[model samples]
Target: MKLGKEYQQLTPEDFTINPEQPEDFQQAIAQLVTQSTSWHGVVQCCGHDFTGEETSVSETGYGSTLLLVQALVKAELSPLPRLWLVTQGAQPLDSHPVMSGVVKSSLGMVKTISSEHPGLRCVAIDLDPQQTVEEQARMLMAEIWSESREDEVAFRQGIRYVAQLIDSHWTQSTLTVQQYQFLQQIKTASISERQNILRDYLQSEIVQVLGMNHEQVDLQKPLNDMGVDSLMALELRSRIKTHLEVELKISKFVEGVSISDLATEVNEQLEQIETNQENNLDNEEQINSAEGNNIDWLEGEL
Candidate 1:
């Protein structure tokens, strides 16, 4: 059935139950699915109630969401039964380790479900819990129906933030004028100099990604060990390819790859390009000289 007026005013208390045992909670979820014909959406809130023993909170929170998703998948008659996962308190980026881990894992689940089910709409909303439940519900409903193409939204201290995923890497065009000039200057530089420049650029990027200073990064260490997740890796690869004007595969950082090694590869590519340019110039000059000789012989015959 449609979650119309009754569901609009729903609160966290509606789903609260004193479970005699954990299995009882699962039974309750099963019953929820069995009774409901269809749902407009599902809203999950993680806030003060989610803060307890780390193990308990994490297990229960994640498990409950999992069950809800499973139930929704089975019962949702319409493709667009929106799922809104709400988190309270500090944003995930600035949260404590335990809280942050839980949020990240939850978001990961949302991403996976969204990827698998194109018709299903999943959004994660983070907001401060100091506001009234009505306010929170209003904001969530607005987000559920928002036409914005963002999957993540946050409301903090009277401010609203939306995350729109765009492919920054693939859209890059030719280098800027400054970049072209710099490339021209470096084209004739020694391989050692070229490698040093590339290495320094990579080191700077790694430090920024890790949210640290350059001195804190070890260029020789593997990037994965430094907490460079898949998303960060894509960003790093994008930055390098865009600025350095070199082609690089994302898998280069898959394993045993270091900044120094990447620098070496960039240096080799530069040298190859320079060599090809020189060969082309020499062939053009020779062709011009041959044409001139033929013209001189024709003049003498005339």
Candidate 2:
């Protein structure tokens, strides 16, 4: 509705291609583009259509999009119209890892195509699915009008972020004596004990973060489905780092992760930390190692 005024809105009947039928879908797309020899842009908004996890490229948008790319690239038009692939929460940014969606392939197609063909203008824009429709519309409009040469971009909270590749280094934080010992004990903990410990901690965090009763929280249900958005996710992640002394991506909460599932994930991270701490043990990294019994309450909680 935000773009209804400026752009000519096409109804579903006007241009909905069935990806299951490759040849027909390809033909439909080719004819659609041939409607005008020159154009401002042809935007393909994806991630709205539902496809199963087992769906192949021929049964998904990927195959249809491939055909479109071939047509656009081979067209004898003077100035190629910009091909815009707009998706929702399909990009993994530096901090907020967007929800991976089926549109990922289409985004990559346009980016690589733009590089191979200088005359073609390809813009891949990822919008935060958590944002309101009004905000997403504004982001799309801004990117459409801006003269940025960046082929790939993502918008979060009205801020535009472009992807870049640079030399990076792995920097580890100095763990305190208590944190190191806790990790070591956690690694030695039995599978059931580990689950009980971390699951209890995660339950407490969820109850506190969402202000829900402990009895009301279901360990098997996904946290995001219980209304943990990006902001709540940030708080939950911070709480984990503070108490557990482990850093986790914000995406961990939103990607259908239940308290039970996160407990297993936390246990795995603790194992990795146990190894790293042992290898990097130094004077500064080590303090008087606390006894494993210090976290005995962890097992007792269950």
TM-score of 1: 0.41
What are the per-residue Cα lDDT tens digits for candidate 1 across 32-106? Answer: 656664666667664345554456533445555665566555554443366777776534433333355655666
Worst ten in a row by lDDT for model 2: 283-292
TM-scores of the candidates in the order shown:
0.41, 0.44
Residue pairs with colliding backbones in model 2 are: none
Cα lDDT tens digits, model 2, 1-302, are 11111222255325444544444444554565556666767676654444446666644445555656666655545455677778776765536543344545756677677656545567777777778897687667656754445777776544456656343221222333234334445555687898897898789889988899999899999998998999999998987786676788999999999999899888888778766655654321122123223345667886
Best by lDDT: 2
User: How much is the lDDT of residue 210 in candidate 1?
Assistant: 77
RMSD of each: 25.0, 23.6
